[model samples]
Target: MEQLHQQSILFAVGINHKTAPVEIREQIFVHEDEIPALLTELRKTLVEAVVLSTCNRTEIYGVTTRTDLDLDFYKDLLINFKGAETFVSREHFFASVSCAACQQLFQVATSLDSKIVGDTQILGQLRDAYAVAKRHEATGKILNQLHQRAFKIGKQARTETRLHKGAVSISLAAVELAAEIFGSLTGKTVLVIGAGETARMTAECLIQRRVGKILITNRTRSNADELLESLKKSNNFAGETIALNELKNHLNEADIIISSTSSPAPVLEKTDFDRQTNKILLIDIAVPRDIAPEVAECKNVLLKNIDDLHSIVDRNSRRRMADLPLVKRIIMKEMSNFLVWYYSLPLLPTVLQCGAKPDKEIQSEIVRVKEFLLANVSHVHKLAMQNGAENFAGHVEVVNTLVAMKNAALTLRLEIEA
Candidate 1:
């Protein structure tokens, strides 16, 4: 029975905005360059793995054959791998297995489980994570199917629901906060620090608010120039690229400062803003934070970090709650579809064993069984697509037949092996 249970178990483990603060999340944050090595290390224990790390969360989705592996096992692996055992602990991590894992990932990919619900960026991030895993050959059949379906379900959620109807991202939330503070942004000078997607989105939002002047600065001047150029084509805003070294020179001129740089440390310290006498609103959306915590102590300076946006996020999340049921329905349906396919996987080997092929021919028999399983999955998927919600009963009947076949195959293989 233990040998029979050796089929791949889909699982997920990690810390997110819900489980840990930005400081702890950043400590375990996995950069794109770090993913390949991490996947290599995880492959020692997992049959397949995908690492999805963003400013708000760092999650590992994996498949393992070992039944002994549990939530704490992955928690310890993450703590040691990220060298974060010093401050982080198992309590800060959350784990899910099998169907729960699939449900968690589906929610994440659809932005239902984000720090801010309806965040449009998480889907792209999920896609990128899966791409990296696939490119590095880190994914096998289980992860490949799971992630592919996750992407599709993510798209379906967005298209079918109004979850993303309002200000749906951290960048937009930051801009909304700035608008609330300043009342009117018509002539407000905004300084944008960083050339990443968040920074670009902030600048665009500022432009939409008719901000008078925008100063963009980045570590790489050319990237800032590129952003400025892109913004110029879209909006007729007064925007200029400033050198990062000269940031302090114009710091006092801006009414609002939005920083989303990927710096490992604070780019703006207390001393940098101490000399400023004018009122300024600074929003730091980066995990490691581009602005130091002490900067909030400076007179007339209002500093808001990622966590500060929770109130705004909560309000917007409530507004989007009406669409939640539809999105969850989509998730539940897809999860059922995925589990049906997943539960059938173990039967492939069972059917192969029942064949009683010679050792030399076993490998070929395994391939044949794999193709058969894939065909059945494909057929089921086709039926679900063609039938839609109204024919869910019919789909379940098809699923029941597949499950019966799997059981019969398992019984035959078990008897032969016994």
Candidate 2:
């Protein structure tokens, strides 16, 4: 009975934004080129496997003929990739089985469980993840169909909901707010502080809106210059890297200042301004507050904090939430269909036995009918002329019954073959 329980088991394990921070998540991150090796490694332990590594999550999905290895067993596989420097171990690595795992992947592909709900990138990421598994022959029929259906359902969610439509990230929300104030960013000179991921994304957003000029500044001049060069290459950005010391001289030139730096204290203070009094819009996205609180006290300064971006995030989330019911309905429908297919696997031998008996029974009946027809052939032909329509009707009905039986036999054979 213990070995019998191994049949048709599906499970998943790993860490995501909900469970781990960027530091911990990065350790398990698998590059596209690394997937084949990982697939080969996982399949050694589990019969079927797929690895989905994205910016916000890293998960290993598996199917095995062993219920003996629990979720922790799979989670340990991910930890084996790299050392556990920042991981909280059990707190960060969550494991799920069967239907729960299936639901998790579907929700992820649809962007329902993304860091920023309704992010448009998860679908493409999921497709890439599944493609790697398929190319390596890592996934069997069950997982192949599961991922394909996940893609289909993700598309259905997009069509049925407005969730993926608006500014999702803090960077995007800040950009959208800028656009609303300035009408158009085509000729605006935006000042960006720091060269971190958030600041890079924010600058990209500004460039996307056709911001006229972008000025980047950082404590280390070399880092600022390097970041500007990278951004320039990416989008052919017409931007300049300013020396941090020149912040005061150039402060008046910027229409908007968005800062996200890892600083212990406020980078932009009231003292940094005052002398250069131009109407300035400040967006501080740093954790310790990059812009000085007193900067907002300046008559010409309009300030917004990182926390303020929540309003936009909430709005976008609500848009996606409105369609949650429809998305869930499709997921449940697909789940039921797959569940029926999964449950039928255990009855394979019984189905085969039941299927063959019908064929023999039908063949025997066909043989009896053929003998009767052959014996009455001449008598039936003469009666057809003597009795006319009544005799002809009787012969036609017998032949029709024979045809029906043959068709039924053919259909049953086809089903068994399938």
Candidate 3:
């Protein structure tokens, strides 16, 4: 138990918009299908792990006992996994250990660290990421506790603070940009290129603006129809579903085109809009970009990609900055609670080893045990920092011991309370 005190390190490693450009982020993005295999590989080194790969960032959160597995090791794993060794370097990555790592995750879950600080989408993203990890058996007691706590903290932050008072998601930012371009959305016709969450959100925003009409086109007509039907239930706006191939025919009629498809390649080429003479605003919010870059060169076409929405995001973030302190306090309080529980884990085995005794003797022993465990835990932390990767072969054994102790302590306490 003493040996395991500081050896089970919780860590977060990866790159975000602040550390890496969108191009690098897209290259590192782990698709849903790739997560299981990636987690399998990570299990060789990590005791517990979760991979969160969104459009704006990709991060790996894990509990590892091996001191040898530093920040560089995780960065190299990502680089090798993505086959991005040629371009991606260690500089694009960032890592935090133990308490710092825990704080980072809390901030992310509460949307404090998002590209748009008050964005409401990150909480659901974190929830989905944790669900995937849990479903795959990639998480253990530590991660299970951490993520569940995060969800509670996230909800608390949103409910108690004004962090989400006027939340502006990426999709909303896109719609705002469209409004800015056209001066008004009252008579504007929007052509939505997909029926996913982003596309739906954008449509909803546009509907609120009283946009004249919304034309939805998708690779799958059923998905497009589903979105159209949902929107119809909410609003009486003229919503129409068009075939994917009919996109070109409607190009001239659409004043603002918002494309957020998951297609691997560009769905709209310059040639598709070459015959268009009417001015059109095209916003491509997809990671791979639904519209070809060359379309920007076409006549009467104004193209904007995801990066173009930064101006609007930045402005919205500033307005939300005043609520940050409130969210920060919530995060700090939650983080402190988590760290207290985490540090107490190693003491579980020692406390259980005390065996049964008279109430008076047990009370006195508890005081002495607390002092002893604190000193030993502090010493272990110092040694971990000083030794780094040296003598780390016993990492697995340390994790196993700590986990067993934690589970046993929990069961015993539950039985006692009952």
Candidate 4:
């Protein structure tokens, strides 16, 4: 029954790398455990919705019929959802609606809005969030169409462009930062904390840099072991995997530390730097941050977050800019196609019924005219009536074709509004 009632408003709200730094973004990071409650809370507002929260962005796409609920109302709710007091004022928020929001979502889905351009990982993250929303039954026809089209567009961008062929990642940028700090990683002992995607990618890049010793520490010992095992087959590096409980003991021993752990709070504080004697580069690539901000004050420790990696990723951004026109063309084309299809939907059944109510009235008129001609006219007038009837049928056929074409175009325009 709800599906039968069309929604008048399509809205999206959130913050992302473009709007917030890693520090502020982390404050709003929704944990998996809290998602269900969030969905329930949103459902009570009578807004059909889907939430996509990733390390880079937190966006809610919803459809509502209530014209009274402005975007600011939902923005306040979103801010509250993540605890507004935690995020700094005058920073860390962005929102868009209708066409702009749809465009932004398409850009996000294609990874064009990612911290790293053409990031393949974000596609998976988007899918994960979509799946979670689907399991929660928060999506309806509008979101379903939008997300599926976004996925298709994302795939098209990847397949059709050279956007994903180079070192465009936070991890690789971290490695570059280490190389800038240390000059060379050839003889360095690199410690990669956490066996997640970021950590593993950083580890790979470090190995590629020909680091002497590699140490992997993860909350789970088995994950650390798995990382080491995978690294062993790649190249001969003297490395070992250890449990996270022993992370602090080994911190001072390493020249470089790249952390990508999923800890909700700061895991590596200033206490970890108590016995440090040498200069150590610490790259905090995790959201909510694995390393404490205070640790940067220590003479030997250098702290860098995902935001700090942006300037370094600017080179990739410049290269990606060249392909923007082509991507925009693709988007415009898809949008036009979707609009045309949408605008033609309501017209389809009416067109199939040969004008429905209007056609019935015309039919009645024809019947009346035929009866009038038969009862009131002579045989000589019957010939003229036949000619008139043929002319009328011809005119009607022409009008029908013209109306159908007009309706199809109108349908396309309607889709554009949607």
Candidate 5:
């Protein structure tokens, strides 16, 4: 790793699917409403922070005042805030700082860190995380820029390479499992539960397989009808819509069931399919899980949940890893551009100097400004003059120059003189 000239304040820390099992990852997974509260607690210590909680990872992309921000602070925060202390340990915690941290964020936003390596869902997930932080005032100039760069890189990575062109997400993985079980779905009937994005994706996958029929069921019949209209195939396609109240009647009729609803509890139980003697595959892709675990115990009914989809996700991710080098090339380019803008900020040097206290050495001038002044500061006055006037940021140029000059002889003052 190149020795980053900037303060090692940027940090990426948390347990992800790579370090922990799916059980633990889901245990700590944060909901949308919990973001404000989590970020509230995080900003208490971290200078700028974003909590990026996804199905595959729960990570904190943060910037702190001090370079030596204890990694335990993140773990303890999760323990106290999300009750994750018992579910995981230090072994599950992974961390990166400075340039490495930037690289991780870029890669994750670009889906390089995903279970489905090139899955684009992460881009939206990252955006939502940034939006939450921005909403809570948890993010500042540094994190704002970092996340924006990540968004740009994510789009560019997809455009410049085949990263997401053939990417398989969790929903698609469920369809893959279906294909493996039933040699071909050309003549099979698929029952889709829910009118949400996941269910729509599953139906699309089934369509690609040339499924003979599709039955959509939703709490609102109108939603099911809307989904049916979208899934309708031209030239003698068979599709139908029904209310959730009618779900039980169709269970035995479907060869495959893909359920991804927002219900708090299991929508389908073992008793719902007691009469199902023919081999049927039920895939519940919901997070809280739309289908009961006992459904798998029903004779001739094979149940697959969100966790089971990961095996296929892992296999597809490995295949997609072939495109990682190309994706990384894009991330590195973006990282370089971000660093250029970051190091040129004059006040950033002041902030770092204030945060990083001088250690046990000679307490000399070189120790104070050599790394701090030259590395992160350039002539802000020079840039301001080109812009025709001294702007607010440019005003800092004089203050910065005076401080550096003073530090050339004496220790940096603990506080600016009154």
Candidate 6:
């Protein structure tokens, strides 16, 4: 028979913290309900794929024969979803196939190159995304196996390396820095400029710090109100919602400002900061920067970017480094397990058919032989022979068939080029 093989191709089109702001990222975030239809639209041409949309990143992973499908077309589709203004230059984008896709996926899964290093949530999110794609039959042999293996590698990195041990999430670092600047959050007024996941995370962290008051603001008043209502559930938080237009007026009133909006440029500019009367500790977690670095020049206005958090996170990163070996061991073990299943995929049906067909043939032959022996042998000799030769020969035929198939598979594999 002619060889049957499939190649995996991965094409990702989206922006991340490195390429776009939170506003841009959020704009591109694919709603869960929209996935099936989106996949349906893409499936007409893409063959099989997975869509991974989160507050931090929106990526597409697929396997297809149409490797030449215009990336601009997909990028245009994303721009329609995310708004074209959010994208900077096209240079920030990436596209790869086979080994390259495999590498990129491994890095993402490990959180090696995430906005927050070693963020564990991403691994689970990736797994869930894969499951959804698989459930919808949107992933084929290539991506199915590659993604599964990448996921295992991610788990291995976490278990084998101290990369994630005591990881300093951006939110936690912002809270810690807030404490250093303001001494305590008990009497401080905090405003979260966006109501997305990062915004919610910042707000939650502030609430945990026992911040005296919290305010939620978003371009969408309903979103701000939604987040505010959620925060009100906590007994300690007593806060209000401010309209996006009202942000500047209350800027002076906030003791701590954490901005995670999806703006293309600085939302809180130098003009927005009032150096006097307000000691605003601004933690900008958004990419493309929500609060301009120049704003930090204002007296009593302490602003920090993502990289600044790395120093503290780095120390914690070192402590967790001790666990890397164990994590690696786990990942290696899982990878081996996954590979066994993966490699066997192509051979499984053939192997099963080989065994099954032989079993049937042997049974038929045994029945024929039994009838012939019954007719030919003496009645006294027939009983023992029926229990021995017929049964043993049938079982032997089945075993021999399996061994022969396995040997054939092994020989075929050895003959194939590495």
Clashes of each: 0, 0, 0, 1, 0, 10
lDDT of 2 by residue, 1-418 (tens): 1111125556778888778765566567676677898889888878789899865688988877654556666667667755554554756877666556777888897887876777766787788888889888898877987888899888987886666766266678888777777789898999999887677888989989998899999988888898889888879667898888787789999989998776656788888878766777899866446787788888778888755665666767876777778778887777655544443343223333244553675665445444444444444334322332222233233334434544565578679999
Candidate 5 per-residue lDDT over residues 324-380, each given as its tens digit: 788877876677667545534432334344556644552453345445544433343
lDDT of 4 by residue, 237-256 (tens): 88998778888888777998
Candidate 5 minimal-lDDT segment of 10 residues = 387-396
Measured over all alpha carbons after superposition, the RMSD of each candidate to the real structure, in angstroms, is 7.4, 16.7, 6.7, 13.5, 10.2, 14.1
Each candidate's lDDT (Cα)? 0.81, 0.71, 0.80, 0.70, 0.73, 0.65
| Candidate with maximal TM-score | 1
Which prediction has the highest lDDT against the true structure? 1
- Models ranked on lDDT: 1, 3, 5, 2, 4, 6
Tens-place lDDT per residue, model 3, 307-347, is 88888988888887887888888887787667556655544
How far residue 258's Cα lies from its native spot in candidate 3, in Å, is 1.3
TM-score of 3: 0.83
Q: Which clashing pairs does model 6 show?
A: 22-262, 23-262, 159-327, 160-324, 160-325, 160-327, 160-328, 161-324, 162-320, 162-321
306-369 in candidate 1: lDDT tens per residue?
A: 8988778888999999989999989888887786667556545564434455465666655554
**Model 5 TM-score on a 0 to 1 scale:** 0.74
> Which scores greater on TM-score, model 1 or model 5?
1
Per-candidate TM equals 0.84, 0.58, 0.83, 0.78, 0.74, 0.64
- Which of candidates 3 and 6 reaches a greater TM-score? 3
**Global CA lDDT of candidate 4, please?**
0.70
Q: What is the RMSD of candidate 4? A: 13.5
lDDT of 2 at 27: 62
Q: Write the per-residue lDDT of candidate 6 for residues 1-418, one digit (tens) a residue.
A: 3232332234455567677665456556676676777777678778788888665777887655453455666666656654554543455455544333444566678776576676756887788888888899998766777787887778777766677776756777778778876778887899889998778878877888888889888989999998888767765568899999988989888888888876656778887765457577888876647887788898878888766675666655666666655654554444344433332333334433234553675555445434433342333122222322222222223223333545565467669955
> What's the best-to-worst order under TM-score?
1, 3, 4, 5, 6, 2
Q: In model 5, which residue pairs have backbone atoms overlapping below 3 Å?
A: none
